[model samples]
Target: MRLTLASYGLLTGIVLVVVVPFLVAVSYRAEQRQPDLSPERIIAASQGAFAPAIPPAEDLAVLELAAEQGIALAQNNLAVILLRTRDSRNHDRADRLLEAAAAQGLVQARYNIAYRIPYRFNTDPALVERQIDLLQRNVAADDIHSMALLAARLGFENRERFVEDRQAEQLALLQNAAATGDPDYLFLHGAELVDRVRNMPPSDHSPARLVVMELALEAFLASFEQGEPRAAQRISAMIAERNVGALTDRLAAMGLPTSDLEWLDMAGQAGLAYADCHYARKVLGDLWPDDLMTEPLYRISAGIVQDALTHPPERRQRALDLAEACATPPQIPEFRPRAFGHTALYLAKHRGGWPAIGDSRGQADVMLGVIAALGVFGPVDREKAAFHFDRAVRVHDYRGGVGFLDRLD
Candidate 1:
């Protein structure tokens, strides 16, 4: 009996000594073959290298692993990849991933989720509320983009039905965002102030409001200096309408550039279509260079004017007529679809006269379609509007879709 028990014990000891060591060796080798990815390397690749193409199978495995391990940036980047790839199922997963990152207080993740809600979530009431909540949270956390978006949305008069004291809160948020020195925020804040002044009754325009308007103009100038082209148009319009001397003095006091010509020159050089038109009309005395086109509309307008200049003296009147038609307003009207439609129709008739100027042609198409659909200048041609709108949307201009929706309601 003792001999039999010893034999069994010896067999157990042999198995432990041999099999256990073999298993441990295999485990160690597996770990050595696949080291954990470093956070820095993953982040860099996700931002640039992995963005242009699909990642290798092994790299995707590593990224998934990192995301599952609660790495917020990894989750956010993976979400971006899924969104780009764009399978319906993957998009839903991407939303979950964005939510996970937002849970970790990632402002960008929150912003992206809010931005996608209308398009991806079909403006679901629940999703819209979630977006508002996310924006509010980010605003409280002092996220600059969040502040700008929230303020802009709230500042619209339509928002008053939803949020109490929307205007005051919107103004405060704009001011907060402007303090960050971001060019976009500066322009938005300045625009909001301008709207406020424009909407107020003349009798109610106090010295305080005028002071705010001056500050807003200064903000616009600052934005222009920071490379915001829209600011140039704003400054040009204000100078053209208001007391230029007083406005210049106010701008100088605020350490902003006071010269309208300098501002126009800068904006024209920066490739703003409106600024180019203004500079050509004011400084060049309607004499546009043959190669002065930057935007498609500019190309059409400038091409017509240039073509007219080449006409014979006897037919110079025809050139002058076309040039007059090509003239853009000194102050761009906010909602002058009639004028825009006229220009658009003229451009459409002479489409072959201008050199093609890339995506600006697409923008012009969209604008013309919207104006025509709204019947702003002439009888509404829904069929023609649908054609242009479809073309614009095919090129990924969702604003065309918005115009369609606006007309629907």
Candidate 2:
């Protein structure tokens, strides 16, 4: 019996020495094999947030693993990706993820949820209340995004039907957001101030109107200087209507663009496509130039484009000849389309004079057809355009559509 007990003790000792160390080593190796889910690592893997492009499969896998591991930021960003997909099932998952993130104190998730609510003067009472509540909470936390969003919601329209002091609240929020000197918020604040002055009674003769106008002008100028090109358009419009006295002098004094054309040019260079289009029309007319084309040929082609309708048959044919002579590879890619479109318009109108102008018109139509068919100009009809836009949206091309697509209708 003594020898058996001693044998058991010796076996127990051997088991502890071998099994415990084996278990410890296995645990250490398992931990070492686990991928890092640190904030920096997850953020680096996150994609499809600010960009139009979808994240690659590898990135999605990394994000999925991190999100599954309970990373709130990863969940929020993945929610954004799902929401952008616009699939109904994906939207449900996105909402759940956003709620989870918001529960974890992610303010951006709350702001995003509130931003999706449609504001129609409190037409939907439940949604309005929910949005207001969410935004108010976020605003209390001093979130600039929430402040701007809440301001927009409250000040949208029909304030009298809602809270009596909603306007004051909205203004306060705008002022707070604009105080941060963000160009977008500054522009919004300026627009709101302009609305205030417009709504005031004319006979009131309140010095407040002048003060508000001045403040708005300052906001617009600051916003424009900070890379908000639309603010320049606002200032130019105000100047054109003589809405603000001595606006041109003030602009000149500040070494800013004083003339309408000057403002348009500045805005154009700042990447406002509308301003660019208008400025190009004002400077170059409807005509577009080919690469390495001489200034004389450009001017003549522009004249032909503008005066094609009034020109005699012989002169029209001569103008077509000049245009053909001016044709070469397109220098300005943007102008290529307009050149083709305008040339086609001229050809269509001059069909009675030159029936054999097929080659010139055919080239233009070929280019225009390619552009139109590829959905650059949206669609050949409204129905197709809507479908194209809808598909583009579903594929996460909303921003790209707005930025790159032009609607013919």
Candidate 3:
């Protein structure tokens, strides 16, 4: 059966209409299953941990295809996946891809490279300027989102330079965002306003300043309560530094079952971040009862004071349990090798700086756990708790800039 020209034409049309769309659909489904190198992925990764909406294997296939197409954004995306994924298999290739995109003047690529540069990439002012410039190119294109970021970086750099006019510039960017109803802009702007009120000289304090302070506090509260952990942490730090009493009252008003002053462990294996806050001791002390603690047990938990009669004991057992359970650092999850590596960090800080617990590690849960374990199992040595505390202080500074990220001032 010899096919005629009409039959060939009909087949070609069929391939274009049916086959092409099918291939495209399959490719799209695959891409959707991986990080699409999209804005959402970038935001999620930068704001929190990298949670690939897609599986890493599937993401790799999509990234590989994007790389093959010579897409600049795709290359950058693939590089980020590779960098974060630590695909040793793709390390060299990912480096090349990033370099290629950076060569093409991709702003995100430049930012990524700048971030990855040695010494926090804060060394050369010129490098930072170049980064700002690349990022600004998009801002000038009316990328409103980029404008907010540019404003933030400019605020930081300008502060270093003592640029007098930056206050207006920062406000202007934020105002634009607010006018457009951008939640991201609101978070940053609200924080800035609060900072302005907080850092003002006492001489400048007035009724108007008080009003502004209230507004700033409200804005921060609004943003924080909406599940913005970074925002909440920032506001909490601000409140912690200033009025722990007031903040605790505010937390109480938020209707938490426990009082605001209590040391509620933040969820997960982060050993003592919750208790380290100033309000923790007071809150924990105010509510916990005394009698149930065994003498030896009573003596061990330093900050602990148990008395059922004097306090609303039943209401605060949850808080006490945290201290009891945290006698050791609980494992978080797979974020480990990093977890124990930081054992050195807690110990070092426990030594030269503020002890993660006290000047001695006896106050630290992990240290306490070690002491308790030794007493029970290994050697029943005297001052073993003190020894753990000392060892914690002597441990290497493993926690590299843990609290510094959201510590924007």
Candidate 4:
């Protein structure tokens, strides 16, 4: 009886040893959601909240395993990763994935043709021409955006043979885009008209010119009414550039309620004074080249651009003079130079801005402030410079130079 019990005990011990390990392995496998995600020779210390010191290999392995498991996002991510690798090894695969995403109408994929969507892509002459052809055929095709892009490309170009269609297309796209009230399109359309008028030929007095200008104004108004701050100032600029007939007279013809006559020259008052002959003439009329201007403001306050080489530079200067006339503020205070930039920063002086000034003098103050802010224009007068810089920074936010840092220094 004693011998039989001993034999049973030995058998039980063997079974326990084999079954324990098997049970532990099963439980471990069940607990794992993805992969073990471990690397050799890594130890953990204190970890931060929202941060984990997972091994790089472990993450890669888990993600790779997930992709193999047929996860959609993982698959998409893997496709992008392969494409971005920019290696001969994965380019074909990446291209296929990107195409697939594009086929799905993914917005990111739509933006992936090149890193940039505008001039960077359309600037290619062949590509733009092709897009124009496609748009001429259809705008709501699977690639309706082709028309949008083509119109956008030509807005600033103004090629002669295709002017009518391009303008029509541009108007359609801009109007459609405007319905959504997107500022970028408004700004782009405005900028394009400005460029076109700045380049139009003096002999090219087509009625289309006037229509395009009106379109630009109305477009700007739409955006302005939506609460863009610079709308009035930009319109004022357009007004000052016009030689359509006369400002007060033309606007008065409509018999609509309006602001003071003085405010008609708001852009000039805003300190965007000075003109090349072309723009100046349109803005200031006969006085565009210098003589002081009052009343009888140019009706079409937008400048029509002419060929730079066709018209002599002096003519351009004359035009600028007209525009400069628009800058005739009621009372512009002068300032001392050397008050800003290097002198102010390195010399440590408080030339102005010690106290706040109210609304009444704001216009003139701002005008002087503009002259001062654009310090590189004239002689260095510290006191005046400081006032200008201070005003520019405090009031208008010094937009002219803010972008300088982003430019190649």
Clashes of each: 0, 0, 12, 41
The residue-level lDDT of candidate 4 at 152 comes to: 57
Which is the leading candidate under TM-score?
2
lDDT of 3 by residue, 1-409 (tens): 3578889999999999999999999999998776565544433333211453333565566556666767666677666555545558766776687678777866556545544433232456776565566545755666455456556666554334533576777777666654554444556777777777767886684677656655555554555445433344444455545434544565568764223232223311223344433222333442111211222432433334332223465534443344444333445454411100110010000000111443211233333333343343246444544443444344522222122112221
Better of 1 and 2 by TM-score: 2
Give candidate 1 regions above 4 Å deviation. 1-24, 34-38, 49-59, 86-89, 103-105, 119-126, 203-205, 251-261, 281-409
Task: Point out the higher-scoring one by TM-score: 1 or 3.
Answer: 1
Give all TM-scores, in the order shown: 0.60, 0.64, 0.52, 0.38
Question: Per-residue lDDT of 74-96 in model 1, one digit per residue for the tens?
Answer: 77766766665637998898789
Lowest lDDT sum, 10 consecutive residues, model 2, at: 343-352
lDDT of 2 at 77: 73
**Of the pair 1 and 4, which is ahead by lDDT?**
1
Better TM-score candidate (3, 4):
3
Off by over 4 Å in 3: 1-62, 85-114, 117-122, 142-188, 229-279, 284-311, 314-318, 325-327, 333-409
Candidate 1 local lDDT, residue 377:
33
For candidate 1, list the clashing residue pairs, or say none: none
